[model samples]
Target: MVWGRKKKRGGRKEPVFGGVAASLAELRLNPLDRITVADDKPASRAAPRKAAGPGGDGSRERKPSQNRKGRKGRARKRTRGRLSRLFYWGAVLALWGGIAIVGVVVYVGAHLPPIQSLEIPKRPPTIKIVGADGSVLATRGEMAGSNVSLKDLPPYLPKAFIAIEDRRFYSHYGVDPIGILRAAVTNVLHMGVSQGGSTLTQQLAKNLFLTQERTLERKLQEVELALWLERKHTKAQILELYLNRVYFGSGAYGVEAAAQKYFGKPAKDVTLAEAAMLAGLVKSPSRLAPNRNPEGAEARAKVVLAAMADAHFITEQQARAATTRPSYAVKPVGAGTINYVADWVGEVLDDLVGQVDQNIVVETTIDPKLQSVAEAALIDELAAKSVKFNVSQGALVAMTPDGAIRAMVGGRNYGDSQFNRAVMAKRQPGSAFKPFVYLTAIEAGLTPETIRQDAPLDIKGWRPENYGHEYFGAVTLTQALAMSLNTVAVRLGLEVGPVNVVRTAHRLGITSKLEPNASIALGTSEVSPLELVGAYAPFANGGYAANPHIVDRIRTVDGNKLLYARAQAAPGRVIDPRSVAMMNTMMEQTLISGTARKAGIPGWTAAGKTGTSQDFRDAWFVGYTAKLVTGVWLGNDDNSPTRKATGGGLPVEVWTRFMRTAHEGMQPEPIPGTQRGGPLPDIAQLGRQVIAPAPAAPASVGGPPQPVRANVRPEAASGLDGWLVDRLFGGR
Candidate 1:
């Protein structure tokens, strides 16, 4: 029946579908509609009798078929997530490891040690110069050098310095490790490389034993040296060494020299403000020099003051006051009394003592007042004669007759140069040496009244002439000396023997070599002005010759005696006391009535000699009062002759001016034995017994029968014999 219904359904399906379609005109229907058919094989499922209730509910109760696949997917997803996490962490770690390695390399390179150079001594403090009042005058140290022990420094000064330059100086063992670390960190943070973390000891090490190279090697060397220094010295000692070795500008090395240079005062006397200024100069001296840049110096000083305030070394009020204080005005260095005299003394020391370092302070015999007056007078005189002569160089020396050099001038402008003309330059003395010749003749029993022919005399091949070619015939010895007659002098030198004159000059302190010829009397021998003054000093010092000396004694800064002047007994008489006295009297006459008359100082018994060399190349006026001997030399440094310069010109003026001022506070004392019988008569005739035949009567015969020839003349007179005859008999 179902098969028939099925067959009929197949036919009827179209009709049902048409009906459904017609009914479904309001509702559309799908084309494959199924009608339920009785199952023919329904009974075949009863074999297992397994009931499927709710279809897949049983499958849900159990593991589903796709559950294993789902579990596998979940496990794979978890595994994948875990693998991704591992990869991400690996990349991060790689990047971090690279960054750490870079940092380590950079740090090691930055802190590496550097190389070393230079060998500096770690010496004790040096002795220095001090004034009479115990004020520092100069120093002896390294360059701009000197030294001072830690114990020598004032406690407060070191404290102040430490507080400002290095606050942790006492705590550190030569170097501050913490400070170094902090500096490193800060430098790295800011990428700035300017800051330094060196301790005081490190700085000293750099200054003393290491180069100032800005490298890690140098820094490491500095650290080693600093540690060694700390082990060797106490902190106080280190600080003192630092203070002394540190540069304080203006060529000053130590605190004492700096104090003298900047404040014109001693280190002990330095004011708070002055000290701050000097301390400030250490950072950059040239840029902060008060002389070159006052504003910058003042600013730096303020910074130092601020530091002092911060350190509690001074109060803020004090710092402000110091900052506002006017800049200290320093006098130019080397501007002291006796600039010329000091230079001359230095030269003399070169011979008497030895070569000295520039740091040496040579105490001289220069009288400040006397030197001032001499310089002023010379300048005024030269200015007055500026039209006639352009005299720029002048020198003067004054000394006690016993060879105590009292005053000196090497040149008019001491600041311009330091060639000491007084002790170094050898200039012709002109007529000044004539007195030595006269003295020689006097010592040989000749007096001031001795007679000599002043005619045209031919001495060997040398013809002597007067200054103006005018001869004063038959003049007395006093007249010849007073008039400075060249012919008379030549004749007298020949009479006394040139060797004797030279020897006599030596006795009077003339150390220069003298020409053993007729020119000796004419000043052909070159002599230093100081030597001339020393030579003439014996005449004023009662015939006693003394070696000229500038230094009286030498001592260390701590008052330790280094050397003392050898005690010398009064010099043995070089000339007869009577002869010296007579020479002194003659010189007095020369000063009063001779070429040096212009040098006459009223109310003072003075003696001097004027000299003008050939062509006026060297002019000299050497003189002496009862207490002082002075010599003035005027000429060009090149030895060129000045236009109108002469011994009686500017030289006399200089001598007179200095003497006038030198004797201002002193009373005039009479020369010893000057008033006693004046000078003795000439005995030249007693010794001179002419043997030649009375000059053949000169054709004018009958000259009082001509005194009988005392001695006979030799027959074969020739060469030396003829020359001797000619010289002794005043041959033309």
Candidate 2:
């Protein structure tokens, strides 16, 4: 019975093995039973187990044992199935977590603030210095127009800008989503962030209201503001603001300023080529300042023109024409104190309009042509003698007798330094002061024909010497003045009183303080060049002194009358008209036959005086034509004596050169109240003449011609001759 039972289990186990083999075969797997059998070790173990099983029937016993082994294999397979399911679910969770992280990163990036927006003020453009004929000279302030509506902007302008700067402006909603995605992809591929994807609105926002900080927070703020602006304002308004607020270098702060600065024209008048050039400046202002880098600016303009053609804003031919258009012409700004005349005008304005920041156009009396001539003359003279005298500085001032300063040069080169010697410097007038002394003497009853001795004179222990240290015994007052004889001037000053001379100088507009001593007769008093010119103008204007002035009128930019420059009341007569006439006559002699004769020009009446200060520190020539009065002062800044500089050397040379050019094409007029007459004729024909027929009467030899006293002279006659000689040749 046991054997039969064992056989039954064996049969069942065999079928089980056979079934497993068949399943393995269907699964195309290597069979474990075959493998174990081929290894032979498993076969031997199986044989032992089968032998011990079921009443020593090995096959029957092995059947039960195989069943147990199969069960264990099935249990192990079920456990592995659970682990596989767990692994699959874990992998799905990890993938979703990664996706969440990426989403967070993208969200943060999109929200970051923009890095570069700053707002600047909007101001109206300033008009530059245009010649009376409409040529520009210099420009001031930025120019800008009111913001235009979106529909008002030319479509081509915005379209061209977009083609170059930002193409996705309208569709991006202030932040470019695709641009961000592309940047992200690029960063991933290259392992670095290397691109900026700012949309137009973002760029506008940055320009309007942000700093250039490369921070995420600022970027987000920029995006928010850009969106806000796009929704609130039209596209044209944004563009207008951008154009007006952009910097174009050359001290220009807007499109209009840039246009005027570079092209010497207004923004509304700019050509397409000029517009492109201005637009190109948006990228680099200093590098392309119209005055600094004109070549680079032109090349950049061509690039902009090419871009315009590519965007179809213009045809290729149009682009070529625009690029070929001549660069806008501009005049260089005057170097230093370009508005020097304007500054003097400002001083007059202070009395008219008070201190205010209003735009004012002052019509001045300055003749630009004369001004140029005067400047050139002074510069040329200084340059020519720079090595000889080591004199590198000088000043020239020309004015109408009515005190209108027509032309002035404050220094040799205004570009080098700006110390206005013509107006601000105060130095000894030297012999220029003698005119006041002579005027005083004339007021005290002296005349040009009066005799004065040009001998050494003692004035309260102040011994005045002639310039050449040699004295003439006797000379006319006019001759003494023409010679600038120091001794004669001291004697005349003592006779007239130094106080009276100072007072007379003040009356004539000398205004500067004078020394109270007799030395003042030799021009020891310090006076400014302007004061000296103004003072001498009385001689030119026939004894009346007109206050020096620059501004004629001031008006607002809108043609509103701000201030009218009516002539101020004249100062009282400083000297008698006759004294002024006589003084002018003597000065005319100075130009014709005196120390300042070099200043004489043909057919022009110029009366001036030469002055060399003590130690040769300052040299001066104060003179005037019938129309103009000019003063020149040459000296060292440190008061060191010039080596060979004198009033007659370069000062008179400059004066003559300047006057020749300044008065060119202008008719010469005689000074008012001047007497026109030649010198007195010789007196040889005054006495009666005897007939030749009277020779027959010589035989008579009647009365020995009244016993003509041999070697016997009348006391009265000798005393009279001596007195006349002393008065004519010893008083000076």
Candidate 3:
């Protein structure tokens, strides 16, 4: 319209700028520019007229508005179709997913026990053995400590676990959806399941009601049980239960037990760093146990502290302090083979406390200090000398003269083996059996002065020979016993009958079966170290038979009700006073100049016998003082012979080490019915004289005696002189 001035005559001519304004408005810079100029003709007609060529025809111009409407209609139809298809497939997939989830839940739930009937099972009974001085020796069975509450634990303790195990524990209902989602994303990124999303409640539910099987079914059941637990108990109670029921390593099954096992303290007393170390054990108890893997445990504890800081439960400074502060666990006082004493106590629990169905405490005769010494001495000896002697294992058993076992070491390493070589293994005692043989002969009217032919002897086709195969012709019985002469023992066994020797051993406390053959004199019969030590007690305890008891008292842990207390009474006399004296005299000589001379305990009068089985399969030193009876055995478990490991070697060394420690502060006592003095009696000189006729009453010292034999040598010493000399310096 501006190109040719609009027919302006009477109608005021449209301003030329009017068209410019319209054009400016129509030059749409954005969608909001919809201004138009007024005209008499229709706007469509005006547009055609403006775009028409000089011929005044508008056919050549294109109309974009109509075409835009049709194209938009087609696009609307396609979008609607796409939305319909997407909705249909989404609904189909959702249905299948729901069905699959329901099927899994049902299948897993069906395999579980009835929910109504489920209950937490009772833990195995724990036998707590205490030492004679009231210190804890060891624990047997499940080492379940006293129950601990999460509230009582240090605040940082529970927080540490929460941060590392389930950070959203308080906010989550039962199972954490956010945690599971995050774990899923992390696992996807790692291409494996490296993190666990189980909540504390979930772990508790599994430990209480389910087996630890890594199956989808078990996981589903765990979720269901977690929900049930949440409904049944508060979060505090659930956490307490979890802490009290979770297992740590080293036979410990509770937070308290783990605390004691690792830090040697109770959970309530655990330090912040200690608590972190214990809390880190949840992932892999055995692998991360502080006592077992301190480095791994420390590494894990640092992770926990870092997590705690991230959760705002601990400050960055606190985390740094904890990380730098090394965490160490003080090993329990008697943790190793000292457990052998605990094992023995558990075995006898049923007899000591009838129907041991609940937690009970057993007061054992073990002296914790002595037990430690014995274990150290035995373990150290074996480690140092066992290889050299071709010995693989050893055992030690020590007891009071009254049969109260003070210490017992069953093996070199309890973790390597728990076979209880001290109380269970039945190995030959070797020449240690000669004591009973001599005792029997003494009872059968023989004296230490009796002359025994040490030459070769054959009994029932068994030709017993001396250790060196060298026989000293006409040796006194004391010399024969001191030398551990196998031939002399065989002769005496044949003279007294093997049956009587067996009777003597049984009367003294040998419970194992004994063979009555002539070989029995050489300890062909197998017996445990416990029984052998016990049987030797009569010589040390003034002829009293030791029962070899361990448990002194038993009582309920909670109620303090007495289950059993050892009845105090005089020990039964197993032998005559004269026989005990004779046995002591003969055995004492062993410590002075015999095979067991290496086993002497300085400043104390001690007596014992050394035994080396045929082929060196077993080496033993059963020695004792007036205060203690100790037996040591060194050998191979498979009964393979050692490299000439005679009883005078490793076994004696171990016995000496242990006995020296055991009698550290004890007062010395002379051998019963004997005196320490100058020289030993010349028994060989007395052999030249015949015995005088015996008086019916006790013979007076320094008195002339009647002669029973016709040929009496004038040069021979009198019986009183011989007796005095023999008693004064017998051992030397």
- Best candidate, lDDT: 3
Task: Give the per-residue lDDT digits (tens) of candidate 2, residues 164-237.
Answer: 55656556666788877876888888888754577767777776666779987678777777777777767757
For model 1 the local lDDT of residue 449 reads 74
What would the TM-scores of all predictions be?
Answer: 0.62, 0.61, 0.73
Q: How many steric clashes between backbone atoms does each model show? A: 12, 20, 5
Per-residue accuracy of model 1 over 465-499 as CA lDDT, tens digit each: 66655444556777677657787787778778889
**Comparing 2 and 3 on lDDT, the stronger one:** 3
Expressed as tens digits, the lDDT of each residue in 404-492 for candidate 3 is 99999999888878889999999999998899999998998988888865655434455666665444556689888887877678777
Rate residue 690 of model 1 by lDDT: 24
- What C-alpha lDDT do the candidate models reach, one value each? 0.67, 0.68, 0.80
TM-score preference between candidates 2 and 3, better one: 3
Worst 10 residues of 2 by lDDT: 690-699
Write down the RMSD of candidate 2 (Cα, Å): 18.1
**Poorest 10 consecutive residues by lDDT, candidate 1:** 697-706
